[model samples]
Target: MRILVVEDDAGIALGLRTNLQQRGYAVDVCASLASAWAALSSEPFDLVLLDLGLADGDGGDLLLRLRQARAAAPGALPDPLTPVLIMTARDQVADRISGLNLGADDYLVKPFDLDELEARMRALLRRAAGRAHPLLVHGELVVDPAARTVLRAGEAVELAPREFALLLLLLESRGRVLSRQQLEARLYNWQDAVGSNAVEVHVHHLRRKLGEGLIQTLRGVGYFIPREDGA
Candidate 1:
């Protein structure tokens, strides 16, 4: 799954990112609310790890803006099922209650264990899925998560292994910026340098077979899959 870590502290953000990466998640780290907003605007993500204290703005306002963004969209791209896990140093009951009221799916106080955080995220994802997996859908596409096959509009779409891998990467990230270097690394080994046109080639094929505007290119940065309306 894709997870966004909105935190200002380098240590905490790195720790969370490393831990989550080890747990088979693709993580994007941002230090300020503005960066976080940029990330959110460009990509789709499965979950968010939001910190109350950010360098650019308050987490409360950020949360409100996120909700407004979703509401403004035609069908709320990320949908209400997308989880937002709040991480804060404040542990007061009022703070927890207020965050929950504001739409946070779960809360974690500072000085917590990474295992606990992972456990909480697993629980949230399970609940979000209605306790099921396989046959993942995004917009008009249906992905057989188990078979690694893709179908769009009821027609089977042939995808290269690399294309399928990249698509799954984007789906797992479903609402976050994925740097080209990051995507390239997934396709190439550590010792091999990814060719300039390799990722573009795979993406081009995927798009031609899938549909135009299926995967959006973020100029100067990377790629993202916009959340579908009502998803």
Candidate 2:
């Protein structure tokens, strides 16, 4: 999934970006609330890792803005329902309550465990996708996002990071069509060097490894994974 990390500390931001990227997540960093707002105003992000103490403004202001943007014209603003996880040094009850009241989906104090953060992230993403289970299951294809493993026809399938990301995204949006642009946006970050046919190559690889009918194409529109019952 694509993540926007709003943090001011250079060391913390770099560490988060590097670690999350290694876990197959596309991450973008914004050092100040202004930059975070700019990025949010222009693009779509699956989740936000917000830090309360930004250089320019309080992260809660950004959170409130994001939540209040639900009335914008369709596609004109960022998704108001997009999950936000507040990561900050504030550990008091009032701070946690205030952030939650401002539409932060989850909160983690600084010096938290990376594993716990990832678990919380997974939970939020799963809830956003309307899934209750951590494992994504579509017929015989079982995907474990935490484990980064896929089981097809009762056998383990090895997929590259991009391929895995593409598969998970398709599964999450099971009946919905996602254009190449959408796939590319979620699969790669600004720092990655990507080829023109990167999504196509990864889709081909997924189909070959999993099954020919696993991912369906729309010729001109987009791609989608069929609903579980083949709808």
Task: Please provide, for model 2 over 41-114, each residue's C-alpha lDDT reduced to its tens digit, 9 standing for 90 to 100.
Answer: 88788999999998888999999999998746755657789899999999999999999999999999999999
Best by TM-score: 2
Which clashing pairs does model 2 show? none
The TM-score values for the models, in the order shown, are 0.58, 0.97
Best candidate according to lDDT: 2
Candidate 1's TM-score:
0.58
Cα deviation at 79, candidate 2, in Å, is: 1.3
The ten-residue window of minimal lDDT in model 1 covers 71-80
